[model samples]
Target: MTAAAVVLAALGAWTDYPELVTLGLAAAATLLLAAAWLVASPKLTVVREVRPRRVFEGGSAQGTLTVTNVGKRDSPPLLVTETVGGHRTTVTVPALTAGHSCTVSYPLPVARRGRYVIPPVELGHSDPLRLLHRDRAAGGELVVHVYPRVHILASITSGGPQDAEGQTTSSAPLGGVAFHSLREYEPGDDWRHIHWGATARTGTVMTRHVVVPDEPRQLVVLDTGSAPYPSPQFFEEAVRVAASFCVAAERSGLPLQLRTTGGAQRESSGAALEFLCTAESSGADRGLAALADLLRDVVSGTQGVALTVVTGRVDTEAAQLLMSLRPRLLSVSLAQLVSPDNTLPARPRGVLTVAARGSEQFASNWNRLVLR
Candidate 1:
């Protein structure tokens, strides 16, 4: 307002217009008064509430905001903003009454996964004359959790582990370790031996049905530590691999578990794969650090039905871990599965590794190794 007054006085002197000087003086006085009132206005307090703290990406969150003016007089209009997954938006609010409150509600759309911090809500109070606006900082923060992206895969095999579920198809008639059921013999059935007693009682032909043994339960250890050249595309590829494995395993009647060196373990029903999309992003580990940490964690836990460690590279520590587990478990290494020259160290018997160019090729790659 003072600056405005000075400008008006200078213009009045240059133009030598008495009417212009009077108008400028009146405008300056009004601006000065508004500034004084704005300064003397009471401070406002704001609160933000987000429903369902943990939400999946592509989900909607209904958020409510409450504003209360602690001052003795009515406050200016307010604007509330909400940020989600790095996206920002502003909302206009009605004038709040002194010592009274008003509520505003909006929807927050989550487009990506990961833990995100919702920045503080801002309160903007502009004077009636609209010369300037004052902003006040509000307290309180919100933490949102987003899960991983899920895709459909026809076959799910733990790339590194033995079959956890005992599953067999009708085509593979060879004897299996897991016993299913026995029935009267049928023509063309395995002639090893027939159930003579049951055949005699029924006076008809039947056959034996054996429950297929499921492949070993596979534990996919993801190396999420920082990479030399960080790329979200790499992370996306890793997620696709994990999703493909989970879907394939679930379809094959196998139980699967997920663990990460960069984050917590995610093990639940097949449906839990949805949350994996939001794994945390870490830029702390470099070179072989991620592989070392993954190996250490594996030694600490013996639950891996089959260990399939998914990483960007095959390091010495990882090779050693596989060597150590070779005698006890069927360990598979999935590193840059799509790249040429992708190879697994030759040491442990029954250990197979394959390069997976993409989701469509995972099954073919596994089929090549499985036949071995």
Candidate 2:
């Protein structure tokens, strides 16, 4: 347009045409006006808020963005770009007068498990003709945690010895159905537990001393070593399996401990789930060694602990290490997530092994185990 206007002005001067000169001047004025409009920048302040910052897989999350025009004059329409879970969304904001604000709300993606960081929003301002524009970043980054999938289990039995009535046998003489000693009968003593022979010989009423069994403790270990998993998908499945077990244990009022190759060991279910949300496969070779140390500590510090190890692959050496700790543990169980075509190893005498292709299959196989 500028070139054409200059040509017309020159032609008018050469041919002495007043109409051509007037048309050229009008064209120049339009160009100047467009340039001036584009040169004026819009002053805006942005504030963003994300609700339910933490959620489980397949859940939903939402966010709101407020944009205010703090300049002295009315502002033109602007484009706002938001980033979530590495995906971008663009929203158009209507024109706002000074001291006026507009808000936009959108849903965030929570299709998978991980920690997602939402970066600062980008505000784009452009002229009416869109010939020129500028972009500036606003607000701060926000982090959202997405936890893994959890499946409910029917029962959590350790498959120890049981009596005819289906009650689990106690290993200690004091805390089980077995009689530990005889004591003088108390006012509230059950008549069924009375020792008639002791009472007749000593001329005093005596009762049997029996201890009640305590609930079993479960320790869940997740293997995050990259070398064991031929693919990343198997490692992810292992994480889900570990998370499911933790949830089941907590629901059943079982004492639960979670240990991961990333060196996270937490007793609270909430803390364990949080750890799994951000856990990643480690390429380093120290995972197995760290796991060994963790198992050793568990064996030395506690008794009657039921061990459950979730891993992508379990080699013979790993199996041997777990078997060696069987004496300290009440029971040992292993869940291995393998490829569809891969064959599982034979189950050891003292260890229960469940092999499956994914989390659902592993859950099915686990529920079938008869834990006492």
lDDT (Cα, 0-100) at 314 in candidate 2: 71
Off by over 4 Å in 2: 1-43, 70-72, 97-100, 154-216, 286-290, 370-372
Report residue 317 deviation for candidate 2 (angstroms).
2.0
TM-score (all chains, Cα) for each model:
0.57, 0.71
- Tell me the TM-score of model 1: 0.57
Residue-by-residue lDDT tens digits, candidate 2, 107-176: 8877899888888988888777665577788999899889998876654566453332332333433434
Off by over 4 Å in 1: 1-4, 13-18, 42-45, 69-75, 84-86, 96-100, 151-219, 225-231, 240-305, 312-324, 330-372
Question: Each candidate: RMSD to true structure?
Answer: 12.8, 10.3
User: Where does candidate 2 clash, by residue pair?
Assistant: 157-371, 158-371, 158-372, 159-371, 159-372
Tens-digit lDDT track for model 1 on 1-372?
667677777788789977767777887888877778778867677778888776644576677888888888887777777777667778888887778988889887666666678877767777887887776667677887655444444343444434424445553334554455666666777765566666777887555665435455667766666462135665555665666666556666555677776655766534446556565436774433554465565456444466665555455655566666655554565534334344643333345555454434655566555654
Instruction: Go through the candidates in order and give each one's C-alpha lDDT.
Output: 0.62, 0.79
Query: In lDDT terms, how accurate is model 1?
Result: 0.62
